[model samples]
Target: MPPPESSGPPLIGPLIAQLRLARRWSQPRLAAELCAVSDVPTLGRHEISRWERQLRVPGDFWLGWLAVVLAVPVALLVEAATRTRSLGTAPAVVGARSRSALLALAQRWLLDPGDPSFAAATGWLPPTGPPTGAGAAPPTGVPALPPTGAGEPPPTGVPALPPTGPVDRSAEVVRLAELRRLDDLSGGAELSGIGFSWLRRVARASSEATPVGRRRLLPVLAETAQLCGWLAADAGAPTDALEAYRFGLRAAGAAGDPALAGHLLGSASHLLASVGDPHGALVLARTGYAGCHTVASPRLRALLLHRIALAAALGGRHQPARCALAAAQRAADRVEEGREPPWLYWVDGPELAAMTGRALVVLRRPRRAVALLGVGQGSGRPRSGAVYGGWLARAYLQLGEVEQACAVADDALLDAVRAGSPRAVTQLTAVRRGLAPHRHRQPVRRHLALVAAAGPYLPRPVTGSRPDPTDRTAPPVGNGGADRPGTPARRGPGGRTGSSVRPVGGRPNGGRAARRTDGRAATHSETG
Candidate 1:
């Protein structure tokens, strides 16, 4: 029977734990209660303890019943078991497949949560501006902005309120959940709007909150706002992104989440650099460095400092850039696996090296950029793949290798499609731009068209110069990202997170409603 066509080894431990956590039950509590209810004497505290810690597997019958109790299919359990066995022999395959499965399973749980109809709806284009049911009176006593000293300027160097008071736990959690949902569903359009809304809401909610909640929710709020600002920039809304980041910086500082604040600042710096404001990016990175020192985790510190280095390089500050890069290397080298924070999950040596390589490219060293980013050239991982493709395209174009540049551009374009991220979209746009000098050539032109066709799904292209009209404003009300294929009157090419195009000029001060080309509401299946 071809050795039962082995699929992979089981990733049973984590799968079981994830399922259990989704149910929100303690191991001992479940053991005692389920043992009595299921009439399985063997399924006692000891067995439950062992299972939770991954020390031992339960018997076959118990396994089947446990799957039911956890609301996980029996087939999934078998798949995990097979993976575990295969992992013992083929570790690489097992690891890759197992990680994919984990992420998939988590996404599923997040989407359905065991009650699909009762979920938060969380359409790709969420209601903008303010949430429903928010109490009236602007959260009485809440400080709108943080207090500022006479000589201390705000992070954005704009006159704004300084952060104060504690974060409201309930309100903050709701806001984060909303932002996270939007992030998962949409690409970039609503990122800034929602982020800005969240900032206003949280700032108001936290006015009279306590110290404990403030500390806990501050980091979350900062991260949320930073993501908003970053996405806004990716959508060709640099100014909006900056405003979002500014608010996020204050929240991060107020909550004492120095590491998180540093990371947000780094993100803001990257946006600044992308929008021909490298000097601004450099300043933001330096500010981030000041905060990075307060973080306890080496991995977090390293990642933040890496951003500083990249920003400085883009800003033409060679000495400080090199110094920051060296510090980042040292900190990264000192970080131990499994000890880093969640945000630093994807920031590894390779990712950092890619950033440094891009910095080299920006500093007019195309050859070095290629060398730095070319590590793990054949790896399928999107993060490294996108960066390598970008650098290669730039390098080949700089060397006047027209054919090679086009080839690399094609690869980068495909990578952007598979990765489905704003960062990838931005990098791939660099590849497209590099090939623009040869735009008349068939291969380059064709590739550019393909990239443009994919535009609706991709993040809006962000140029360091003037914005593209398609990106600067939403399509006419009747047309939007969510238009159906072959729908003549729809007015737009594609849909992202069910977003309908916003009208040009001006709309309502509150969030604009999704509309069609004829200035009417349009609906698609994905909106559900």
Candidate 2:
């Protein structure tokens, strides 16, 4: 890649990026466009990214095409490129020692999250200036791992360690399946580190695997990346989640599987929204659907539509959210069993209900959110129940049923901690924030305290959850803990409702789900 800045009007790269972001286009989408129109499919996101950073300027020939597509005059593009660049605008490049240190620390935390030493990565600061005279190489990352012989295994329980030989496609599939199940049992806080390392190992082994094995492995890589993204989102690490999704996109494109690529796009769209970039999220949602709506399976299309609707809801675009929601319903109804991909098992009735309800809650149609999400109260990931509880709490609060909302908030708090879910924690925070008006009330204060006191999820080995999708035998991660705790008496679906609560007017969502940089979801609503 070229340096981020260079002299003169020929600085075509940042110009491309500025225009693209202005149009809400992802780097991949623009790259795809270039590839489509080019004589030789020579460029991709890497090239587009390079151009934007002024790392390597695109030739004038491509610049003209980009200008036309960007709807900017060639003269304007040239003008922007000619301006002197500031080094401050360039991407931050960490020292190689820092990079190694960060990666090692990340890997260590993932494999052993509960270790108190995780404080290092969370708090460590770089040296203010240059390194000291003696030993200053980022603490010589990973101080004492057995540096194994040529053929021996590295160590037990140490993830991301080099494998002894080539990985087969089947092994990667099995691992992906395992990781997905683990994510369902817990969240990314418990699984991301290991899953990331697993992928790295698979990637390293790819060179040794046969051509046929590599082909099969690519799609698995894509899916694994999505799984990691999901984990990262749940754990409140949106950047890491998005990184995983981007990797998924690249792997999916290389694998030549539109379905997988579409899923990655949709999943990433959701992540973008979760991270508070609703407009960017909306753009990705549209891009995902546009790319695959025609040829994708009905289930896949429905998934994409759900993402679009979710992003719209988060962005407070009620009409668009509503339209997408309706389209998602239609697409969902058209799913064909054998035609849908195995990875889509989570996108069933419960998922549909949750997605719809989430949008509605944001849209301020809380009553409908309660009705739909409550009906499927027993579905989706194990920990989603906590999220459902929080959503229901917000809906109740809207209806002035303060007691019920408090009750629901209390119910979800334990699950939030048990599952280590940042997403759930976010919902709980919003629930508390909304209750500020009723702070004088004892119940509300107690609930607020509960929400505030809830700490990061600590992973305890779970057992007897859903049966492993790939393996016939039951997974060891069971639903025996907080997940199986006696069900709370919810007010929606089978339960009776309070008199103060108003009925939902159809299915409009009303609020923006603001995400903190740390990955917690917050409510950002508008009165449409």
Candidate 3:
């Protein structure tokens, strides 16, 4: 067993304790229940006590049994275990100090790839060819990409394609944009493997291209990296997501697109803020805005500014956050259709309103938050609705509107279930905690029971094997360093817990419902 002192903040332990307590079960009771459910009589009170106390982490056997007895998803327990094991060890510092170092980090992420086993288990397969249109269905029976080793080339018989000119590049970008739209429909958990596969293919193609061709392909690679990073973060693989963002930043720099680089930086900043590193998030957000302020399109500028506003709010810089929010609103107002990059397609009025509302909630201006968040709530995206509505519910709670809070929370919970977003669920968890004092109310009790019933079926974070983090690179910012993923809770101003909102990326048609392969209605998924 690992030393108790080095075990960081005890993710699995707290999670186990929370679940156990939620059911009003003591250590011996939980152990007995586990043994009874799994037909294994060996587990006892001492073992359960050790696991909850962080003296010893549960192994896979116990984890499986615990999931069964506790009525939670096994994947949740698995992720908690992975995070617990990693917490004690210092994260490998893959700082983006230089281009070469960044490339090395990218290579390491490429080598690790996604968890193919999980992908297979979930019955998700990457598309056989590039996405063709908004309604395109991913073809079935495509063989999975073979695993590769360090310094090894891509799988045999899969030769890298030569880079093409503007027309082909545009086609690739359009294809990726379509994929992004698809992601908005299906949650990241479903498409993360596909995103990684696409990134690997594009990275390989870029590597083989001549200098001129590479320049063309580099932008595509950068775009692919952005999408991959966004999906990875949404799926709760923060390490992979960070690596993808860093790789994209390098590619965007090499392609000489400060706007694209800024977008990557802003995306990374959003990831950092979500994982509880507000200081680092603010630094990167400021850096991104600074880098592209002069050249970014109206929509991109708004997106970047919004990132800064959100980061600042999370970090407790009230005045700066307010200023950034105002600037972002102005930028959003000036957006011209068809004038922005394909990647900025999701940044629009409603999205901006949602983000601004989230900032206001963080600032404790619940009344204003309710108004802006209401406008944002009109976006039909299920995941966005779940997330923003959870915040709206919190705002209601702050005003002591228990009935309204519970009603909104009920809708948010339904959306969260439909979207299959872990972040949405986590956000709702916070809202549920906020409603604890009102549990005596009928509405609150109904919502609480609903949430409890839905817990096991909700999607859990899909984590892969940990990456090698030996090298450090200082990303574009001079003094900023890579923020560690999975930090413990951070307290904001006035003793409020720092909360995170989803990254910027507007879904198509304000998250209009899409059709799935089975001809069923498709709901919006988590963006970051």
Relative to the true structure, how large is the alpha-carbon lDDT of every model?
0.49, 0.54, 0.60
Ranking by TM-score: 2, 3, 1
* Candidate 3 structure quality by residue, lDDT tens digits, 274-384: 656555566566666665678889888888777777777887888878888888878878888988888877777777887888888889999988998888674778888
By summed lDDT, the worst window of 10 consecutive residues in model 3 runs over 501-510
- Give the CA lDDT, 0 to 100, for residue 363 in model 1: 67
In the range 1-528, model 1's lDDT, one tens digit per residue, is 011111133345556656766778777766755555454444455445434323233333445556657777767875654443332210110111212222222222222224221111211121122111112111112212343565666433122232345545665555555554444433343243335555555555444345565456556666767666655543444444544555565565555466676676667656545544454455455555553555547876676666666667766877777777777777778889997766555566666777667666766777877777676455666434654676777877777887877787677767655543445555566666677778899888787787778766553322222221112222222212123455332211121122221111112212232221110011000000
| Best candidate (score: lDDT) | 3
**Alpha carbon lDDT of residue 70, candidate 3?**
87
Query: How would you encode candidate 2's per-residue C-alpha lDDT over 1-528 as one tens digit per residue?
Result: 111111123224435655786688899898777556543264567556544534333333455566667887867754544331221111111111111122222222222223333221112211112111112221111123445566666455333332456676676676676556656655554455556656566655543456676667667766877776666455444445555665565566656666776677677667656546565556566656665566788888878887888777887888878888888888888887877787877677776777788788889998888887676554544467677777878888877899988987787777666654446566676788889899999998888677556542322211211121111221211111211235332121123320111001111111211111222222111100
lDDT of 3: 0.60
Shift of residue 448 alpha carbon in model 1, Å: 4.2
**Candidate 1 global lDDT:** 0.49
Model 1: residues with Cα > 4 Å off, grouped in runs:
1-186, 190-201, 208-212, 294-296, 375-388, 417-433, 436-442, 445-528
lDDT of 2: 0.54
